[model samples]
Target chain A: MNVIYTDNNATTQVAPEVLEEMLPYFSNQYGNPSSIHSFGGNVGKKIEEARSKIASLLGASSNEIVLTSCGTESDSTAILAALNSNPEKKHIVTTRVEHPAVKNLYEHLSRKGYRATFVPVDKDGNIDMEYLLKNLTGDTAMVSIMWANNETGVIFPIPEIAEEVKERGIVFHTDAVQAVGKIPINLAEVNVDMLSLSGHKLHAPKGVGVLYVRKGTKFSPFMIGGHQENGRRGGTENTASIIALGKAAELAAAHLDEENTRVKTLRDKLETELLKRVPNCIINGDRGNRLPNTTSIAFEYVEGESILMMMDQYGICASSGSACTSGSLEPSHVLRAMGVPFTAAHGSIRFSLSIYNTEEEIDFIIEKLPPIIERLRNMSPFWQEMKKKSA
Target chain B: MWDYTDKVKDHFLNPRNVGEIEDADGVGDVGSLACGDALKLFLKLDEHKRIKDAKFQTFGCASAIASSSALTEMIKGLTLEEAKKISNENIAEYLGGLPKEKMHCSVMGRDALEKAISHIKGEEEKKIEGEIVCECFGVTDREIERAVRENHLTSIKDVTDYVKAGGGCQNCHEKIQAIIDGILGVERPAKKEAPKLTNIQKIRLIEETLEREITPTLKKDGGDIALIDVDGDRVLVKLRGTCASCSKSELTLKHYVESKLRELVAPELEVEEVQ
Candidate 1:
């Protein structure tokens, strides 16, 4: 079956080029970057080169990049480092739409005596900038926000928020796992103190991530070990994945325009066709100011897991914000935060495109998805009542 | 990603007896849109009180739809009493099995059936069965107790799996656990004397035990395992992650895995490894 992969926000396929660049590091170049021996020292040089590639991608100095295990680790490192640096500050501010890496951590921190204010979002999945600005106080040690939401693909104004928070001398961080590769980010122009990004989201292998800490930012080690990553994040490097990430980052730099144009057109067509063909469905996020690759659509009276299963049979891969798939009793925090109604929230499906997605695949989904929704809606108990009432 | 059985996939892909039976003898609507899954069942009975026709309209995941379809299929041609005897487990069994978290889908099937039967019996709609326990899911205490009694659910998580009792904000987990303990305490004597676990029940127990009891511990040690097949008293499993490569993995299997399975699933069961 020809699998139409559209769940890039979940994780992406490792690009063949990225994978190729990484294979040599697994065995032939498997030496400790920390060791003083030339063989190991040669590996260290490759690490520096990889670091530069990542830094170049983000418009940052190589010294500012700290390699970690994954995005979650980078999130933990950034948030914890901010708090650890300013121990007196007892408050944290983050949006309700942050990925679990930040949101769950803030929740844990809330239980541990730190005051966490979860700023709300509008129905369009836009952050309530007023609430966020109002909540920033003298006691707030850190303000962590996501540059793009994983579920909704809603992009937050990271640079603007960063500037405001930095002006107030509050440590600012953004989980850019979704935004980094798909969007053009020249962090040298933004006032963010720290940024978190994962490798797998950008066609690199998993288990490797980067925490870009602005130079001279107050920091404490999350994984304290050997003097690796300039002691900001400490662990022996995930060499192959790190190398893969560098190549992926370089590719991302090259493909930024394609992401914005070709991928965006495919995404728009899927969104437009599905919305036109399907009834009682609405886009969950803002039509504008969202990541080019994502379209979160909610089909009322039908459930997301069923939609996904039917799509799976056609080799269509996507994700859902529905509670059934969430492994909880409530729908996604992102959707709920946006005040998306229960009718729509239960049926929300996020179709995230990538550079690999083709127009044929989009058209196939456009052709096939309407019937699936109609079938499920036909089986929905509410659909019967709704039709009867309308009649 | 739900690991739905092929039977479930078949039913979801091609659900049986869909749509409403207008002017039906009994109509039962259970669950709400807020809950993420809802079902409405329509039954037409023969003059002899046997189900002549059964149809359902369900709004839920694949398993929920499958479970509803399975219920409609299973209840047709059965007398009201025989149909009443069909439990949530029967609904799940009809589809081979459901993921533990998804057992509530089968419970939804059972709930819809009960509601339809109540309608046939002239029971009042919205007659609160018991005090609402899990405010989030709106699961009732009677429902929890009944699920526990029938399913032998041992923990708050089990209650959540069976009926979604504590699968929310978890504010009522303590109350749910209390209900579970109370039910288990009342049923302990009868349990020892009850019939031995059926193959389906035994497999469910082992899988639940693995998920609730053993998987977390193994995961803490950077390892995991999958139950391959159950052959009479022998349980086959494949160790994974750190456990797959560890020298003491065999010991881990015999001492940890076997003991845990024996304690929770069945005493006579043996653990074996398959390549």
Candidate 2:
């Protein structure tokens, strides 16, 4: 069966071009970049070339980017570095809707005797900037927020927040794993001290990520080992995935316009047509400030897993912020934080499109999904009670 | 993705008897909107009061929908007495079985059937019989106990899977464990009240605890510890055997020896590694 993949925010398929660029590194060109031999020295050049390409994607210099295992490691390195370097500061601040990479770490840090404050969000998944700013004080060692939420795709105004945070003399970082390629980010203009991006989110293979550290930012290493990544991260380079990430970054730059236009249109059309066709449905995030490729929709009185299961029969892939899907008794914390009701939170489906998605795939989903929702609603006793109440 | 059986997939994709039976003898409604799943069962009886038709409207996941469809299919042509006897396991067995996490879907089927039968008997749905344990899911102690006793559930996670108890907030996990241990006849080690000990008494208890609790385990790794002297709360020790020259001997002394001594003998006792 032909598959219509729309769950790009979860992870994208490795672009063919990236795979082609990485093929040589996996086999014939397997020389260690740290080795002194010419074969090894030549591969080092390719690693630097890949770094420059990734650096160009974020408007950072080659020296500023330190390759790491993944986005989670980058986040840990950045936060731990800030806290360790500034031992006098005892508090750490972050938004409530951070991905587990940052949120769980902060919770763990709080248990380890550091004060932690998670700023709340409004019903539209919009961060409470006032509350975030008010919580920042002289004691805060670092402030780490996200550029775009992974589940809801609501983009935060990082540049403005970075400037505000820096003025307070606190180290500012953003987990731009979801935002790096989907949205335009020029770190040259943004005052963020640190930024993180995962390769797999932008059509690169997994196991490779980059942490862009601004020059003159006080730093410490998370991984203490071999003097790789300029002793910033010590793991032997993930040669193949790093090369793949470089190729993926180049492709992302070339396709940035198409991603913003065609992909955004497809995402918008899917949301508009789905809402129009299905009743008792509402979108989850702020429409104006969200990532162009994402739309989280909530269908009331029906569960998300059932909707996703029905969609899967037609080979249409998607994701949900539902508790049943995640094996948690409660729905997604992001949705709950936004005050999405239990009725809708259990049925929130996220359709995150990429440049690979087409108009026809959106049309197919638009045609097939409404009936599935209606079918589930028909079997829903609440739906019957709702109609009776109205009648 | 859930590895749903072909039977589950079939039933979920095409549910049976999926509309309200308008002229029904009984209607049973269970679960709530906030709980993420609910079911309404409609039963129609024959002239002889046997179940001639059964229909349902459910709001949940694949296993839930499949279980509802399977329940409607299972209860047909059975008397109220026979239909009421159908268990959650029977419904799960009917569909080749559900994932352990999705077992609540089968429980939902059984609860709806029980409610439908009670509705026809003109019984005011009995008030909840026990104190609520899991506040997140509104699960009760009696329900949790029954699930543990029936399913031979051992862990809090097992209880949660069977009855959705201790699945939320986790404030009631200890309560659930108490209930499980009660049913399973397991004696829990009582919380030891640390009695105040004199200087000599504390030192003796520390040595006793080391011999009885710590020595046997340490001997497994060719390691041993000898108490030097006790100065107030500090118990200095000499690491012997393989632990004597080990690089992590200090770590073992502080992390393992001190913690065990503190926990078992006296909370104030500290272990220091000495030559």
Candidate 3:
């Protein structure tokens, strides 16, 4: 069975080019960059090159980029550094729809003597900017928000938000883990103080991430250890993955146009065809201001895990924001935060595409998915009740 | 992804009896859309009270649909009295075993079956027997206690996995713990004859009482307790962080700390502030 992988938001396939670029670092070039030997010193130069490539992709300075283990580390370092730099500020601001990386960290912070203000989102998953502005107080140490929602693929207005947050002297951070490669971001033009990007979200292997700290931003190290990442982040770098991330970043930059055009077209086609074929289904996010390669469709009355399982039978990989899929009692926080109806929230399926995805894959999914939804709906008591009510 | 059994996968992929029985003798619905899973069971009974046909319409995950399917198959030929003997464990065992978190799916099947049986007997639907313990899932104390006793659940998380009692806001965790303790017959305090206590013994008991009983309750409110000193019956302590800032720390110190110490150590034990 040919697997049609569409769960890119969860993680993407490591690009072959990225793997090839990283193999030498694991074997022949296996020198600790921290060592003073020439072999190690040469490896240090390669690390710098990788940093520059990643920096270029984000429109950031090479010195501003600090490589960490993953996006979660980058988020923790940024948020903690902001709070530590200004200890007098006891408050933090974030959106309610953040991925667990930011959401769970903020929840932990709230328990640890920090007042966290979770700004609400609209029904379309658009952030309430007025609520955000009102919550930005002198006591707010930082405002952390995501660039794009992983579940809904809804893009937040980061540039506008960053400018407003910066004007108030509040440190602004954006977890751009989902948006960095798929969307066009120029941190040179944006006023965000800190930005996080993960490797695996953009075709690089996992365990490598970049925290872009704007120049002149006050800093404190989260992982206090040996002077590495210029003491901004500590511990020996994940060398091979770092190199792979650099290659991935370069490819991402090159493929950015294709991502917006061809990938977006495929995603739109899949979403459109599914909606056309399947009745009583609704899209979960702002269709206009979303990532080019993602769609979250809720087949009302049917459960998401069942839909995902049925899709799995056909070798079509996807993900769900539903409760059963997450092992939680409620559906995805993103959907609930956006006030998606309970009827739809439990059945939301997210299809995130990547550059590797083809039109045939999308077509295959379009062909296979509607019947699955119809079958599940046929078995769903809620669906039957709904049909009767409508009748 | 859940590690579903092959039996579970087979049942889910090719679910049996997947529709409502028209003019059914008994019908039962359990769960809701808000809860992320629900099952509607329909039963057709013969003159001898044997199940002529059984069908289900389920809106849930693989295990839920599979459990519903399995239930219909299991109860098809059984008389109402025999069908009433089926348990959530029996349903789960039918499908090899459901993941612990997905155990509630099996429970849902059993609930629907019970309701269907009750409906056939023309009995009033079982009223929610106890106070609501988990507001998030609307799981009542009776429901939680029954699941705990039946499943032999040992932890709050296990109870949650079986019946979704303390799975939400978790404000009722302490209450759930009390209910579990009540069923398991584990005394919260060791009530042996009070032994003569050395200063060291008293201090150790105070620390143990604070760590075991008082700290967990305080920590739930984002507060903490520290044993500053233990001099005789007057257990001197300090509240930290949220506890220090909380205006109700006095009540916490008196009502919570003193009462716990009195019960666990001695009735005459007193707690006082060091700061």
Candidate 4:
């Protein structure tokens, strides 16, 4: 069996076209983009082109974007910038579901005498707007919310929240790593002040990301060194990766409509089939509004690792919400926050799709997974004896 | 994943003496749904106080299943004294050696066996003459000391690996350590504390906790819990009758079980849900 890659949310394999576009900067185009020479100036043009391509995707101007090494760096740059820009504002409002990249930073800030209000989410993984609104005060520096959650794929109401922050003259930022290519992002329409995105999430190379700093937002550079990214970000440009990210962004913009329709259908098909075939199975998050390519399922009884290992035996790859896999002694916080049972939490699997996934591949997995679950359940003393006791 | 030997896999895949023994002389059930695993051992004792037949049903992860299966196989045809002599080490050895993390699976098996023998001897509620060291699982100093003597356990964590002592909330961890230090005759070595339970032990603790705390609470609410299995630290269990579709408050079973197990056995045990 060909190994199916379903953990796209973790990090995607670089697209062939993106890699091809990046190959030149490793040798042929090695000049510093800021040098006075034509070779360096030519390198600068390519960077601008990539930046423009990225800008086109997000409905922002090329100059508004500042390239960074990764999503964390982008997030750190935006958040710390907002904090440092307004020393008087001591409070930061955020959601409970933000990735550790933001969560850890907020925690560190809290430790350093800054107050952070963590707004709660409902059982559906939706953040409470009223709670968020009530928490936003005069002392609030910024309202940083993830555009879409990494684990549950719950789409946060970014525009609604951003509009509220904008009215208060407070900064609004969003980590768009999981949302960039999966959803239609229009900064021109949304009231967000800053947005962070990673290249690897969209089949571009890792170690490259972009932070869109709205033209008039006050900012401070996170990486302090020689002037780069127009003095807004520091470090020698990851030229090849940036170009690849641009090409990948171009591809994403080109195929958005088709990929959205096709991938969502396949995701829905896999989810529906698995639910039908496997007993006591359930979908983790809301089905109506979510990423087109992600489907999380909870298999009641079997642990996620056992399911994942069996899936590996048949070359079906997926991610899990189990604590054992997450290096925590507990299951995924997203599932826990949603009041998912401990039994199902460890047994939960996330099947995240990409453009490359096919209906036949989904069918193959659907056809193969149920029996594996049944086999595991049959081996279970609880499952087998319970049936007998009940009968 | 646990580094389960072929023997462990064999026993887990084709577990010997599965199902129940009708009119069993004694049935000792331990572990729990919240603890992520549990075992119900059915025993038939001979006139000479020897185990004529031993069978088990486990609800937990792969290692717990293997441990229960291996344990049942180890006790059959052995005298009650011989079965009591079957330490977790002997069970692990019979399974060709479980991973350090998974050592608790075998330990749970041994605990179940001892409990079965104790029950057969009419000693379920009888307390031994030893100070309580691990309050989470009701493990006494004698139990920890015995585990050390039989298994040559060097550390408090090792004792937990073999007997699930000090595996839970760890309020009694210092007490467990004191017992271990006193038994090892080491002048208290001042060192940073170590987590008591291995990954597998954590799962057994969770099952033990669920059995001890969670299920009884559910039973009080007119519901019941049945453990499924312990795979690593993930426990699998099934809710019966009302618990299956009971009010959302049943979620408390998992938290109560996990916290109680972590409190009593080891902090690492996680309660997992099963169908």
Write candidate 4's Cα lDDT for B215-256 as tens digits.
Answer: 787888777777788776656667776777876644555567
Ranking by TM-score: 2, 3, 1, 4
Q: lDDT (0-100) at residue A107 of candidate 3?
A: 96
Candidate 2 or 1, higher DockQ: 2
Please give the CA lDDT of all the candidate structures.
0.91, 0.92, 0.93, 0.82
* Candidate closest to the true structure, highest TM-score: 2
After best superposition, candidate 2 residue B114: deviation in angstroms? Answer: 0.8
Tens digits of per-residue lDDT for model 1 on B1-275?
A: 77889999999889999987877889888899999999999999998999999999999999999999999999999998999999999888889999999999999999899889989988788677899999998888998999999998888888998888788789999788778878777443333554599999999999999999999999999999999999999999999999999999988999999998998778888898897
Q: Arrange candidates by DockQ, highest first: which order?
A: 3, 2, 1, 4
* Candidates 3 and 4 compared by DockQ, better number: 3
Best by DockQ: 3
Q: List runs of model 2 lying over 4 Å from the truth.
A: B191-275
Q: In candidate 2, how many Å is residue A332 off? A: 1.2
lDDT (Cα, tens digit) per residue for candidate 2, span B1-275: 89889999999998999998999999989898888888999999999999999999999999999999999999999999999889899999999989999998899889889988999989998999999999998999998888887677899999888888777788898888999898889999999876788887887888898899888888999999888899998898898999897899878888898888877887777777766
Clashing pairs in 2: none
lDDT of 4 by residue, A1-391 (tens): 6878888999998999998999999988998898889998888889999999999999999989999999999999999999888978999988887899999899899988899998888877888899999988999998899999888788988888898888998999999999999999999999888999999999998999999999989999999887989899878898899989999999999878866899889998999999998998888877877899998898876667667766777788888887435323347778877888876786789999999888889999999999988876765556766677879
Docking class of 3: medium
Residue A21 Cα positional deviation in candidate 4, in Å, after optimal superposition? 1.6
DockQ (C-alpha) of model 1?
Answer: 0.61
2 versus 4: better DockQ goes to? 2
